[model samples]
Target: MPTPDFVLALREHVGHDLLWMPGVTAFVLDADRQHMLAVRRADTGAWTPVTGIIDPGEEPASAAVREVAEEAGVDCAPLRLVDVRTHPPLTFPNGDHAQFLDLCFVCEHTGGEPYPADGENTEARWFPLEDPPPMNDRFLAQLQIVLADRPEARFRR
Candidate 1:
């Protein structure tokens, strides 16, 4: 995972202190609706939809598109906004702390096969949505919200 330069600079100032971050997650589904592309994170070996931090000056939707390409080697078009959510604070193994405001999106697969294009993922592949590897509540919720195809975006106050 490439840490944005700004985040690296911020860490220089605050070390492991908590920082609020903006991020994006992509639920990349297949045309058949049976499988979705996801990554098994290299760090924790946990499965997650394509996700990455939003760079400074970058649009959230753009970040979601970029994450899908960079993490899964797939091209996609944002079909709809899924949700805007604030996740609980987290601390990495190295003790860096952060809270995230995540923008989730559903992307229609445009082209390319799925693979782990970046080092952050051990593997990237399409998984059956009905039996996705156990994931956090937020991820499952986003999956449900996106799958529903509701006209309105899911929001967290």
Candidate 2:
């Protein structure tokens, strides 16, 4: 489930060539907005908001909701798109290279308990907004944006 079938098909043809892909990150807050859900990635062991590649023809908001549920075992309703940015290209340990246009959404947890529901993550839990597990600069910045409670989405220009 980590790599989509479409992406796998493309990889079969292109091998390790760089792929430009659309991705989504969901910062899901509890109903009271005091806790944020995070997952420790299986690959990197870093705690981050729920993130996944957007499937072909999928709506971004729906993708965010789906990723939150799939990764964290929690259903969520995307409140708003919080940020859009193109991340720097990355090469996985397996040598597949890709760059992502990440669309970040601030979502409200609607149901279900959080756990690492998918094999992609090793742990999943809710953390206090004031004291979350350490994350990379990109995710940290996105968290700050969601915390600011902005009504409008940020677009990197």
Candidate 1 residue-wise lDDT, 85-143, digit = tens = 88899988889999998888888788999899989998998889888877888788888
Top-TM-score candidate index: 2
Task: Score each candidate by Cα lDDT.
Answer: 0.88, 0.93
- lDDT of model 2 at residue 124? 95
- Steric clash pairs (candidate 2): none
Clashing pairs in 1: none
What would the TM-scores of all predictions be? Answer: 0.92, 0.96
- Give the C-alpha miss distance for residue 82 in model 1, angstroms: 1.0
Candidate 2 lDDT, 1-157, residue by residue in tens: 3799999999999999999999999999999999999999998899999999999999999999998888889999999999999989999889999999999999999999999998999999999999988999999999999999989999987
Error of 1 at 34 (Å): 3.0
